[model samples]
Target chain A: MVKSRRTKAGDIGIAAICLLLMIICLLPMLNVLARSLSSSQAIIRNEVLLWPKGWNLEAYKFVLTDSKYTWSLAWTAILTVICTFVSMVMTTLCAYPLIYRDLKGRRLFNTLILFTMYFNAGTIPHYLLYKDLGLLNHPLVLIIPNSLSVFYMIIMRTFFYSIPDSLRESAEIDGAGPIRILFSIYLPLSKPVLATLSLFYAVGRWNGFSDALMYMNNRTYHPIQLLLYNILNAITSIEIQTQEGFASAPGLSDTIQAATVMFATVPILLVYPWLQKYFISGATLGALKD
Target chain B: MKRSSAINRKRIANYLRKYWTLYLMLSIPLAYFVVFRYIPMTYVQIAFKKYSIVKSPWEMPWADNNGFEYFIKAFRNLDFLYALRNTLLLNFLDLVLGFPAPIILALLLNELPFPRFKRLTQSVAYLPHFLSWIIIAGLAKQLFAPTNGMINIALNRLGFESVPFLNDPVHWVFTYVFLGIWRNVGWNTIIYLAALTNINPELYEASAIDGANRWQNIRYITLPGLRPTIITLLILALGQILSSEFDRPFALTNPLVNSVSQVISIFVYRYGIRGLQFSLTTAVGLFQSLICVIFLMAANALAKRFGERGIW
Candidate 1:
């Protein structure tokens, strides 16, 4: 009975520690939400903590209605969808050929794929190549340049390789071509991997900023991340000006910045839980491969 | 003999014809690599040249006969050394402090009896990984504000002095490392937790039969089981020694703390993206990539020697 009580106490201690760590992990995000909703004056007075003070939607109103933020959101969504689809299709197609058991020069092809993972041609040549290809500022530049991630392709290839050879042999005997076998047999069996890859590609494209920043010079083509970057830059500049006493208002800058951050992050955070299972599974697939 | 040779060539041609569609499918990725990855490597020569936008990357005049001139210039730049130091320091601290955090968290979570609470905590902890650096940085600014920040308020309530969390260079590394742990620990923990589940339950049962306490079970069974994973992760982290967290510092850094906050990637951006010094930026990028390649290869070799699975 004494031992049981001690064990119970240990469990409680462990639970408490876990709870506290979770809170610490969540504190920054909660703080952002609190700061966004709190009145600028209340925030400046340091009244906000776990909850908002003088609860206001003014910040959200400004961010949502703001043309720049909304337009960038639309662009990011469009780019993410298009890029994810392109990546999935290309990766699937690329893996299909490599997965064929009887394909000649398979080893050489696999090595060629893996080579890109180890060595890259640097940035300038890529830029020049894009310029020469007339892909500059084109939406396709974002999708095409990064359509095939070799690491992901390899994972999908491994998944395909796990399918029994008899299945393909039977399909071939039934007069189904390679394309039909891929669509009818391999794809259905590969749903988990495809789902995982799709989520990975989607999240990557959604968060992608550097590509837009580099290739898309036109502001119209800017994704949400680049927009957020510019917004942060503007906020920093405002802070610098305020320090120099050029701007009289202080609270407004902080509120706007907080709001912009919330706007940039909240949508992604909302969709994250939906993709969490896939991402966790996908991350482990590499470790699981013997 | 000529007839046999011609027949052999015909057989090879027939084989190629049979797999024509497969080759066509393979061509797309190959084309992409050529255009996107391989061709870009040709431009690395610009590092030795006074590359002009008007002139071609190849046609540009060499700075000197020696290929090391730009490298020397990069080393001479005060910011380069500072950036390199800061990058290495941050990566080292992260590997030291941030590496074990997720594994511990995963183990603790694995011990939880309440499934609902476990799921909730896992979801909440992992939420930060999805947030863009812009948002994380913005949140950091609010929490770490010297006077009116929530952290300062809490400190004041506890009768401690309000710390200049963001501004002070001394605290920069700690803040960066801590923030990294907060944002990434959950995501990292998921991998270990997955590995832990693969641990057979019979071992635990056998340990229990032997009267092994929880601590002993964890030490003898769990730690030993997790060694390979821990080593693999360590090697992966070492491979990324030069690539510091870009978004975190980019967002968190201000003029006051730029010295400690600046990293090689940020440095490249400052010169390459913002300044449009394409040639120099490419040079810096090449330099970083080369270091990363060397470190990655070295770590892989070391991992192989240590009998751990390395990412080859």
Candidate 2:
């Protein structure tokens, strides 16, 4: 690290800019929090700024007890878990063989996977294919179709490459097969990268709702993100109405939407702090190597 | 030659037996690619075919016999052109403006004297990146709503008219671009900060010794250090010039701004999924994929020409 004088003009300037940007970044999110906690009337009146004008959990109560929100949340949680598990397994399996220098057809497999990054069959065909495969409207639609992200596979592969050859060789010498060696040795040694990838997969699967939107026609099958999206639409659509009741009721809609947004967001946010350090390092190193 | 070929075949068989488990592990991914990736590629031919939902994709008549019809139709469609233009324009705007944001943020963050403050700020900045476009869109709608949005409220407080951030076409694009930067700039900085850490400190020391001021040192040393990374990312960004992102656009777009916001991906969704016009939309999707491939190849070539790492 380069040593620098304290309180230099450059330092002050950089810190100030960073701080200002941070506030800009944080303010909207914080405002949502404040709005969610504030009374519906305060929200509609635009009385709440960064602080709650009237504190209440009525909106939160609505979100938690609502059947639509709860069902979608359950689907999203299950989908995230299954998708992450399948993705991690496939990524590991795909990345492992490619690490071996003597693995036949390694270049062919790598090229096949890499080709996908630049080109695809596009959305329509993928949708049609999924439809044909009986994946449409099914929970597996979210999991199987996107199970192997080539980018994450490459990240994991790079991590596997950094592992010493001697470990694998020794394991093999003791009669460990590739599967055995991978299970007993490689997976044990790859905790940080695995955790990083698990978080990536989990977060990605959790936030992703396009699949649900496209594939599932049943509102009951909608994921939490899609539910939140619909809820937001309700909030925005409320703007078009000029009815006297709605005019008086705009605040409740704001608080309800804000509460739903937080309900969808806070669970994922809770997971972030646990894996953030690994996520940072993983992202940085992965991008550099890429 | 015949005898050597037999021996080579036998050697291959022996090698397969020894590492059969590895191949077994790989077979799953290979099968996955074939089923999910390659099969969809075959379906792309439907773009050229007289596609019928009732018929299997393979049963559709090929384009050369009469298939360029949809392609011609797509070209003639004014909406398609608009979508293409909007896609290219939005992506280009992002490339020009949004691309440099993270690099600048990373550089500024690097200049901070206190590590603790820097780390805290970085974490806060990265927070938005984790949010889904759905949540971001919700937050954006709340913040920019014409009547009661926080920004509008502030404007009204200052005795100004509420800006139609979501309704107005031009202002919508501005909001789209700003939101894109807001959500991603911090996350994008991680790579650049990593690149910053890789720069040799001694070079900076040498520059300081030569009486180079901070700006001069940054210009000559830091900028040069970041050149490869900047070029690599720019090349990657160029490849995505046609891919006006689906999530952000889809979530944020309103019926009022559909003219400006109806991008290629959205067009695909409209025609393919909702309109149920498989052939027309597939043609559009194929056209997009072709352009994307061309862009990727061109970018990779440029990177290679500059002696930087090509993505391939």
Q: Name the candidate that leads on DockQ.
A: 2
After TM-score superposition, the amount by which residue B229's alpha carbon in candidate 2 deviates from its true location, in angstroms, is 0.9
- How big is the positional error of residue B294 in model 2, measured in Å on the Cα after superposition? 0.7
Looking at model 1, the pairs that clash are A121-B41
Q: Model 2 off-target regions past 4 Å?
A: A1-7, A235-251, B1-14, B63-66
TM-score of chain B of 2: 0.93
Q: Judging by TM-score against the true structure, name the best candidate.
A: 2
Clashing pairs in 2: B63-B67
lDDT of 2 by residue, B1-312 (tens): 999999999999988877998999999999999899988998998998987777898897776637888899999999999999999988988888899999889878877879999999998899899999999998888788787778899999999999999899999998999999999999999988888888999997887787777778779888888888898888888888897578989999988998889999988888889888888999999898888889978998988997887776
lDDT leader: 2
lDDT of 1: 0.79
lDDT of 2: 0.85
